[model samples]
Target: MSLEDLVRGAAAEARRLAAAFPAAGRKDDLPWAVIAAFDADVRGHVERDRRIEDERDRVLIASVTLAETPAEAEAEEWDRARRHLVRAVDYLEETVLRFGIVNRLAAKRGHGAAGDPVSALRRG
Candidate 1:
């Protein structure tokens, strides 16, 4: 899948997890599987693209932090997890926007045929 699609999916899953926080009585009640999948997806992109490494790193860190919540987490812990999810979503969305802007600028400058702006920038 495209980097954009992967980031978007991670963002969507993060948002979903945040929304589900209200019903979660403990960390285990939250979606650990989904968080793990999101981490793997973003890590894959980070391995492939140096340009987005920083942003993807932030997302990964936030998700990992959220995932590390105590099994017997309280309201405060849940709130913290929700905030981390928000951070991940924010960074993922920012990465998506950056990708769009970079791609458009690359295309306008006659570099579209070279593939994604990330690869083109690397080539330069």
Candidate 2:
């Protein structure tokens, strides 16, 4: 399965099990312990996903900082600022989509795409 589907399924299962095993109730299932068959792999995915998000944030901050420098420039400077913004947006869009943040945020804002989150499973 694709990473998105895998993450989604894991999220669903975690939700389902949350009531039965509340976060506060677990003892032996410490932060270092594996809770399920796919626990380790899922943890790795989460770590990588978080790293990507962190990188995205850094890129955005850098872009904004660069953008500020051109804000007071003349016509040519405005063009430079526009270019900077475009590059920042492009990089962020790709990173956000790779992390499925766009779809997840869209769903939260009632703008979810019709595309299946598990389209790969359906294809096979």
Candidate 3:
């Protein structure tokens, strides 16, 4: 199919999905509060994860700087860098999954191995 046709199809699908949103409820219903609570819970989990990752980076940095030998420090630095790349790629794939686009061009994108970071990392 032509690129224009694909774009139009995706736009139509998005509109169809948007139309499926639930209608507003009666005044007696507490759905708004429930939705807010769900939002807060998700935000809290995300924030906690960030804190944990930050701590790990901080500890790794301190250890690498304190290593007695240059070779040891270099090894520690490489290990920490590898860990960071793994986490970043994992988050990238998760974000792509949440993205609404069908991503038909993923494998065609200019990432060399595969456009998907997680898959490319695994292949290497």
Best by lDDT: 1
lDDT of model 2 at residue 115? 39
Per-residue lDDT tens digits for candidate 3, residues 6-56, read 323433332232222113223222123222322332222222244434433
Candidate 3: where are CA atoms >4 Å away?
Answer: 1-72, 103-124
Position 78, candidate 1: lDDT = 67
Candidate 3: which pairs clash? none
CA lDDT, every prediction? Answer: 0.55, 0.39, 0.31
Steric clash pairs (candidate 2): none
- Lowest-lDDT window of 10 residues in candidate 3? 38-47
Model 1: lDDT equals 0.55
Error of 2 at 44 (Å): 18
What is every candidate's alpha-carbon RMSD to the true fold?
A: 7.4, 16.3, 19.8
Location of the lowest summed lDDT over 10 successive residues in candidate 1? 113-122
Against the correct fold, how does model 3 do in TM-score? 0.26
Candidates 1 and 2: which is better by lDDT? Answer: 1
Listed in order, each prediction's TM-score against the native is 0.49, 0.34, 0.26
lDDT of 2 by residue, 1-124 (tens): 4444444454344323322322333433421121242243233333235645554454445334333443345766645544544454344334433443323433443433333332333334
Instruction: Provide the clash count, candidate 2.
Output: 0
